[model samples]
Target: MAIDVRIPTILRSYTGGSKAVSGTGDTLADLLTNLDGAHPGLRGRLVTPEGGLHRFVNIYVNDEDVRFLGSLEAKLNDGDTVTILPAVAGGALGFAAAHALRG
Candidate 1:
């Protein structure tokens, strides 16, 4: 199965400056493995040593957030488009917490 992956700016160096890449994998985990094989150090950036997704990173398969869909185990079919978007919070979480405390 062929999967499309989006490369965030922070990790584009591993992709030869490309913002996107494509490869084949039967599962999301396998896809990530293939990415690591191709890019060398990409897997370290995406998956933790314990094989868990990084806290600040989010992955989407066909526009569905994998966190709600079995995380790294989320299945993908041929032609699936996976997007890797890292979370960016600028006091957003703190603001929300403070607002909740005031209520």
Candidate 2:
């Protein structure tokens, strides 16, 4: 399946400053892996070394938080929109850190 992933402004640098990117996969994990393949260091920001989602990040599928649903195993249909959100502490500082680290 092909899905649209909305890259938050804080993490756009990893996608070469793209706000949205399209990837093909059946599950969220696969989609993320594909994205990381295209944008180095992206997977590390979203998922931990233990293969779990990072605590500071939340992934939404079609406006529904995937954590409340199935996490990275969430099923993705064609055209689904996945939004990557990184929790912010101090607005600017958090965003800047996300950009620098993920970029």
Candidate 3:
């Protein structure tokens, strides 16, 4: 299946600065492999050495979190949109904002 993947800003270098790329696969893993083929070193940042999705990375299939849909095994279809995002934690004002919200 042909899929459109949305690449995160940090990983855009692998894609020649393109924020989106096209790949073909039946599952998310295959799609990523295909992407890596065209954009070398891209998959290594998303998948771990154990062949699993990286802990700090998040993937979504058609707007639904892949973690809730079989993760890397999540099935794909033509025209499906795959989104990759790195899990972000505290920001510049995170601590203060969190404390303010807690009060």
CA shift at 101, candidate 2, in angstroms?
A: 30
Order candidates by TM-score, high to low. 3, 1, 2
- The candidate, 1 or 3, that scores higher on lDDT is 3
Tell me the TM-score of model 3. 0.85
Candidate 1: stretches off by over 4 Å: 90-103
Q: What is the lDDT of residue 66 in candidate 1?
A: 89
lDDT for 38 in candidate 2 is 88
lDDT string for model 1 (1-103, tens) is 6798999999999999999999778778889999988898988888999999987888999879989888889888999999998887557467568879999
Kindly report which residue stretches of model 3 are placed more than 4 angstroms away from their true locations once superposed: 90-103
TM values, all candidates: 0.84, 0.82, 0.85
Off by over 4 Å in 2: 89-103
How well does model 3 score by local distance difference test?
Answer: 0.92
Candidate 1 backbone clash number:
0
lDDT of 1 at 19: 94
